[model samples]
Target: MIILKYIFKFYIPCILLITAVTVVLCVRKPYKKQTVNRVVFNERYFRKISGTEKEKYLDSIVTSLNDERNDSVSRDLYLKAGEEYYYLNNIRKSFTSSQIALNLSREAKDSSRIAKSLYFIGDCYENSQKDSAYYYYLQAQKIYTLINDYEKLGRMHFNKAYVLFYDGNFVECEIELTKGLNYLKNSDNEKLLYSCNTLMGNCLEKLFMYEQALKYHQYALGNLKEMKKNNLDSDEVNNFNVSSVINICNLYDLKGEYSKSIKELNAVLTKDLKKKWPRLYANVLSNLAYSKMKNKEYKNVEFMFLESLRIVDSLDYRSDAIYKKIYLGEFYLAQKDTLMSLKTLKEAYRSAVEMKNTNEILRTLRLLTKIDNRKKVFYANRYIDMIDSINSIRSKISNKYARIEYETITVEDENKILTKKNFYILIFSFAAFLILLSIFGFVYLKYKNKELKFVKQQQNDSDEIYQLLSEQNEIINKAKEEEKNKIARELHDGVMNKLYGVRMNLGFFNTKLDDKSIEKRKEYILELQNIENEIRTISHDLSRDSFLEGSDFNTLLSNLIANQKGLSRARFKYIIEENFDWEQVQNIYKINVYRIIQEAVLNIHKYSRALNAEVKIQLSEDKILKLSILDDGIGFDINTVKKGIGLSNIKERANSLKGNLDILSGIGKGTEIIVMFDITR
Candidate 1:
């Protein structure tokens, strides 16, 4: 029994110890195998390689690092691979590598590396997916700013501005360029300084601020010239000089100095430069042609345009090619070759529609309208619709720019205050360390409180803006409803009554006709019946909301008058200025203008007992919409008569639209209402 007890105690303990040791050793064996299989890469050797060799070296490093369990080293290797792929112009691969690196960096909680990876991803998508690129760039900018990497943050802003510029968001691009310039002002990075100025010039040019654009372009040119004189003869420097010269030429063109622009472009058309920079060369040629066309140098204009077209075609520069085609069409139109103009413009229009090029589409539509009166209304309506879309996009871009600018300024102010406090704490630390700590603690608490207040104020501002937009939308909806009600009343009262009168006249004719005269009377009765049918059709069209859905204010006014003709005894005459692009006006402004006119006409129909009324919509040279409604009706005294609901609604809508309204009325005289609103605002 004693031997059995010893066996149980000693043998059981030894067996349990053996099992635990064996289990641990088995786990350690796999770990050792993993260590043996893992490969180490030499980054220095990869850096030493060049060209294809360097790319291959990077690939090797990536392959080796993929199996490594160390996230930091793997992320660094992926970043290197991404850079190599970017240099090779393998954008998809570059994006994939950067995405992997971004994931790793996020897992590691390394904000700086994550920012870098995001920037790389942005670069990869810069040309293909601009909105995505802009988003990534903004993400990187926020992180870089938070980490106090001003240089990278400045670059990020510039990159974002580039995407905005390409997307035709000039106002936002201008804002970003301004921010980048501020960040890089004290920096010694001459390359970035030149890029910022160049982009700023381009944005200003697009915004039609010609003088500012010229100044910036000239400044950039001067910088490049100085650099050239200082023996900076690199390809990048040369490219900058060429680009700056092109910008100056474009500015001159915009400023109406056609001769000077032509001269500048001519000087840029050197054979060597053209060979080295085909795209720039083509653009210069195209601009030279346009300048020549403006200067009325008609002989060589076509030749220059054709040459630019050929160059761009060979280079597969789709946007440039499209621009050249449009220019060619315009040239044909100016030369009075209607056949050729229509042909080229039609082709260009189709291409522009396919490309969704808003500018080109509007230009082509305008030219086509001038050539073909048959399709004038159709093309004009399309052009106006596109203009509204472009304006909306610009408005959104402007709002975004304002928000980004506000946020950037707020953050910068906070950073400056924090930096100042830190400087003070360091300065006081040696003299009184405890006092420094107390001061820092107090400053920190104060900063936190101020930050909270600032955040609250920002939230309040945002809410106010949202409320204002909501109110505008509500006003627009109410105006549309008022318009619909007025149309319904007109259709029911005027058109139906007119049709009933026609039917009664026809019935009387049928009763009065004898058998011998029946054939002649039947002809007259048939004419009366046709008139009734026409009125019914007109009433049906007016009843549908889609008939009044035209974006052009003038077109909508025309439709309104047509519907009113059968309903009202008063003759409505409308005069709209020809040169105005009514599409440039905001939808809310258009709706308000439309409702005001509609209400005034209804009021005249109800009580004016007028014979004639005139409605005029004109756009002034200063970008203001001027509206006038006059009726030769028995007018009431302004001081004695209380305003009705119609008049009150008109006045309220005008006020909400930021317009000035003037009412002139006197007893036994006509009534006239004039409204003026600034469209530019």
Candidate 2:
């Protein structure tokens, strides 16, 4: 019995322990084998895959490594898949794969891979989602900058600027392009540099900076010419050359040199760009047709338009087709073929609406209103509403651009300050070292050190003064440019459009001079009188010196109010503190105050639907200038309604003058704006 108990306890426990160890080993052996098999399979798969099989091979690898812990290999596989998908034009898949790669790279803390993945994702969305593309590009730019990857950084900036240009944000686009050019100054990427210059030219063209635009375009063209001379010719280089020619032609067209535009387009047409680059070729043809139309070569205009349309249709270029249809409609209208014109225009309008092209829709609507008088009122109302909405959106874009410019300038100024400080520190450190050496060598060196210190101090002072002068000059130049733009807009929208209306009315009156000729003549006389009043109002607004030379502050306010009353339906009243001396206020302060009031009144006239408005100006005994504008209009909710360009301008003017502005308004009530400035400050 004792032997049996010992055997059962000791031997049985030993057998159970051995069996547990065997079971654990047996379970781990298959896992190890599976891992080894997977690695070998991945290796074999990669080796067997051809370049054309990259996407398929990548997919298999990704699936096999989905639960694997090797992040580096996984991220690389995802990146390859993304690149292959991008080339295949599967942007959604490309974006998804790149995003996965980006996340994996981030987890791995791989900056280079992160940047590459971000750039790939940006490219995938560049055409469809501009804002998202810009976001990713900026993210990639930060990584590139951190890594000091200047080439990729320059490319990122260039890409972001292209998207901005597409959004019509030319100011910010130019800023970004300028930054890219600075980074690419010594880079050997001639193609990227050429692209940067070309895009900069386009931005400048849109901003109406034509001289600079032409210079940039010429620079790009010269680069291409140099590349050609070096036998570095490819389809891409040839296409760039063709595009540069087209851009120059478009610039010429914008500048009203239609003959030069046509000549350049003809030169482009001589190259056989049709087969290799059909879209570009079609664009050139359409531009050529438009230039010919503008030059009044009516004989070839229809044929050119038709040929361009045919090419566009063959390529299934819907956007270009929409514009082409509009051109055809215009051509038929000019030829007095009302039936064909209506047909083409309706089709164009439908296409534009479907495409969500606001500019084309507006153009089509206006043309329809002119062609079909039965629907004139309907189309005219739509046109006006669209114009207003477009204007509002453009105003917001301009504000955003100004903010970007200001922020860029601020950063530049800070960098300059930092650089100047570092330079001074170096000089001072050197001087101190020299003083220490002199202390050990010669007693006369003390005076020499003092002289050096004084010289350095003088140089620093001079540099500071120069910097200040430069900053002031920049501010003045910016102000001048803004004023010029404002004047141009006023002339174009207010004066020019009115004059065009007068001309059209005169044309109609001249055509219909039957029994109602006298009544029509009377109406024409009244329109001329209205035009004269408008001209007078503009003259008064521009006549600032006359009001400021010796006139009282009340007189200036009175003149502005009178101009508004003449130009608008709103009644205006002015109340001013007696015995206030406007001449005591600084010229700068007075100018900004005048502008603020002018902008506020204009807003009231344009948007407030106000019947009566009042202005109050007071100079307190403590030399505080107080100005208030009260309008009995259909007021807006100040908290809910975003400020428009006019209100923003008023606020900016107030800030420039070191004033406090308070705007109070509520729906169904009235708006009251009050501004206060301490002239003593």
Candidate 3:
């Protein structure tokens, strides 16, 4: 009733104005100048129409505006058309119209409008063309930054965070996404605030922070609903609310709560599906299929998948279709139709690879293995191979994330320190202000005999600031010394113990005599040989330089290989790509790279197996060094490998040098290690 009232109220005035104009023209046969004014006034009245009539009114306005060469009117009409197409999920057309709007905006030299248009263009490709979306988002972010429009910048960051999520850098992505949310928290921009909240919720859900995820999703939903209630004509509010539902549904699905996911999805279906939001419809259908499959409703699953595919195909959604095929392959595999499963899975894999969708590629590979057990051993072997390959990639990402986190934490810590410093400075300044105020007051009060009290208060405040500064300095010094001591203890206890054993073994061999018998002579000879190897090993361990001061690049590597002698069952080999003198490589990069490899090898020896191992280093044309340590043994799942102390240490060391490390391994196969870094002497 309210919607109808709104429509009628807006249109009735336009109709009355048109009728009055007709009456005036028919009754008065206006003078020539008056006729021109009437026509212009009547055309202006037509522009006041609303609802469906408003679209026609705008179109008519656009025609008249174009005839008058009104750039501003044309730009507004283009933006409206683009928005309508976006609402209808005519993404390609929306993109085209937005591009036209962007060109117009650029000509108008309106930076904000250009950024807004670029954001829409980014939205069009965000799901299917991630790289392109990221590029456009970056372009938009640049403009937003130039204009100091932080709200748009935050939205761009949110979009970039999603791209990173798709690229499989979930940790760093979470960081950036959180940064965006933080920005929104300080702003009142409705669109950016809602987007940041929803995307942050998605990120938290992916990280398994379900409760926090729900909170943010609910926050977004509540905000969106409030906005919608006040402004029914707002397409953004409608889309935002629908999107919140979709995100909640996805989160429930990830948590394996199929019923909840279905409930949310069904709610969206009843609300938005019939309202002509086709992309939203497709997304809901895809999610519904996911829940149904999870619930083992295979027949219904296939139906939903097909429905999603049909809709997405109609829209030429190449990536969406590929994903649906991935789901279908999963469904077929569940039904034990191996041939169909293999065919569908292979197609999905190819498409994903072509699109450079690493996550999808991993999924398809996993499903493909289930389709044919005859290929099981082969696939398992390859899966192990992929484990290493994927692990290496994952390791690089992990290191990147760790570095990002470390840098973030460092910045935060530094900020905290700075904040403390600022607080002290503020305290000092405030005390100074108070003292000056007191002095002024004292001078004024000297006439009234109150100077003593004011002077005493000033002294007390100044003393308090001085005391606070002293305490903070003492605390900082103590912390620094404690941290240094902790590091020293770790090195002494961990590495020194091993070195002492080597020394003891050498000492034992030095005392043994060979004069007793032939057997005694032979035993002594073997003992001496063992002692010599021990001495060499110890020398390698002790001779290595610190990462802080850097090591001799060539010697750092040779020492690494020699330390492997401690592992009884392993045989080691080294392959350096270049014949150039190892001294040419910088010391700073070599030690850290070697330590990363050392840590990986140590993990392998302790957990993988004492078996055949290989270390290869290649210096590429770009001065990029690739180092790998591979071992043939029982390899564990890299995905399941938690960032333990050793792995964390490895990653931290690698990150300090801005290098990359990759670990690949699986059960009964071998572990492959790869590290890459640039060398700067």
lDDT of each: 0.77, 0.79, 0.69
Model 2: ten consecutive residues of lowest lDDT: 31-40
Query: Superposing all C-alpha atoms, what RMSD in Å does each candidate have to the true structure?
Result: 19.2, 22.5, 18.7
Weakest lDDT window of 10 consecutive positions for candidate 1: 428-437
The order by descending TM-score is: 2, 1, 3
lDDT of 2 by residue, 21-114 (tens): 6546754633332232242235566557775676676567667656666456667878877887787777887888898888889877899999
- Worst lDDT run of 10 residues, candidate 3, spans 32-41
Pairwise lDDT winner, candidates 1 and 2 = 2
What TM-score should be assigned to candidate 2?
A: 0.54
TM-scores for the candidates: 0.54, 0.54, 0.42
Query: Number of the top candidate by lDDT?
Result: 2
Off by over 4 Å in 3: 1-183, 186-192, 204-214, 231-246, 256-325, 331-340, 343-359, 373-681
163 Cα displacement, candidate 1 (Å): 3.0
What shift in Å separates residue 583 of candidate 3 from its native position after superposition?
26
